[model samples]
Target: MTNTADHGRVRDSYDVVAQEYRDRIGGELAHKPVDRALLGAVVEAAAGGPVADLGCGPGHVAGWLTAHGAEVVGIDLSPAMVEIARREHPGAEFREGDLLRLPATDGEFAAAVALYSVIHLDPAELAPAFTELRRVLRPSGSLLVSFHIGTEVRRLDEWWGHEVDVDFHFLQPDVVAGLLTGAGFTVEARLEREPLPEEAETRRCYLLARRD
Candidate 1:
């Protein structure tokens, strides 16, 4: 697989710290069975049908979708993660691509999911990303996303123990809902709860949006 060097940068970042990421966020973000059940519900609810795990890293959700008989593709910015995904989950299609420029036709998906994926993108960056998600989702498609919500913006001074250059952005519930609405995703479900981390003062927000 030819790696776009730009894609290579993401690959390197993840490669440099893959184990660290897996350790830190992996357990905290572990929702394999529960996520599968919820995602299945979203797929069954959508008239267009099928679903995608947007920004799918290591292809966990994509693997579950495949097992559940959904036409699924896992997309991620990191080529290393993509490689690992393809290796680990042979049946699922794992592509190295940006969320902003999704490689799909308009209304191509019945659902789009991003679990703790947008934590790396700021509001400005996320607006266009949401636009892509909305663009590909069928009219009745739903988007379920989770992110670390906070009152203050946390610049990514580092990621998973690596001194990374990328900036990470956290959002409050209102701002996230506004972005979803602006991007043509009808905000249907929004929930806030305390994060699992003891030091985490912020809440974990879940948004379920459908195309309008």
Candidate 2:
């Protein structure tokens, strides 16, 4: 189970920044070639079935997946974020959901993407988050997860200039890979890349895994 306080903090923080977050992130694909390519491959691997975008903020990623021919459903912890996602990507479905205890059925999706979404999860929630992800995927289903690569807890008192509370946890890639493996996922690929000059200084890690 997710800690209520922790979940509340994350929800409220994103709620406070929902519109600003959408304005800034909704068009990020225009500048992020690598992310676009990775998401493209993920959609291809999904093979035309439904894909879940966990922690989908404004639904840009889900929108991209929809354009690529895969059905997409975006889930976020904040209702405000889900609202923005629904408005921004009318073709795709959006709903409020917790990563550690997703409001989804077992084997409900053929693939799932958690792009930079796990950054908001505290250390203790990581294991259960991945477990819930695996539970929602069919056998041999794909999972594409990305996160900042480090060992730091970045606390924000405000976002988009709005007062709020949130903690962004940077985790080691190997540690996350191990967590996925222990959760019954077969780690297929891992990539680490230096941040683009216009982006944050922190390195990013992407892992592609499959439910065994």
Candidate 3:
């Protein structure tokens, strides 16, 4: 079961930093060629079907996907984030929702992307989160998930000069892959890469899976 208190903290913290976070991180994909390539692959695999951008912050990824010819719906935990996403990326849809209990119908999305979003969930919450993701995706639909690669939980008491409480959980690639498998997904591709120079120093992992 997911901790509701922790979810509240995360939602409030993100609401506090929504605009600042958008201004600083909105243009990240431009410098990331690999990320662009993978996103393009997702767009192609979606095959003109709607793609859900799970935990989409500021709608940048969803905007990028929209620009690349994919229908997108961006979901975030923070209402402020959703507002900013709607204002900034008018081309795509944005909604406030939780990962553990998404506001989506079963098999609704043809493909989904959860970039650096699951890092907020506790270890025990991960399996349920993945299961929820699987529940929304159509059979054979693709899922791309990215996270920091490690076994540490970094908590932030303050961010961007604002009082906030949130935790970022690093996870092992193998462990995440196994959890996806347990959630009825077939692991397809796993990629690990060092962070870009302008980004944080943490190594990152990306897993591509297919709903079975």
**Clash counts for the predictions, in order:** 0, 0, 0
Model 3, residue pairs in steric clash: none
TM-score of structure candidate 3: 0.99
- Best candidate per lDDT, number? 3
* Model 3 per-residue lDDT tens digits across residues 19-44: 99999999999899989998998999
On a 0 to 100 scale, what is the lDDT of residue 128 in model 1?
83
TM-score of each: 0.81, 0.98, 0.99
| Model 2 C-alpha lDDT per residue in residues 1-212, reported as the tens digit of each score | 75889889999999999999888778888888988888888888889889999999989999999988989999999999999889878999998999988888999999999999999888888998899999999999999999998899999997768999899999998899999999999999998899886777999999999999
- Top candidate (TM-score): 3
**Model 3 Cα shift for residue 29 (angstroms):** 0.6
lDDT of each: 0.71, 0.91, 0.95
Candidates 1 and 2, the one with greater lDDT:
2
Candidate 2 structure lDDT: 0.91
The RMSD of every model to the true structure, in order and in angstroms, is 4.1, 0.9, 0.7
Query: What's the candidate order when arranged by decreasing lDDT?
Result: 3, 2, 1
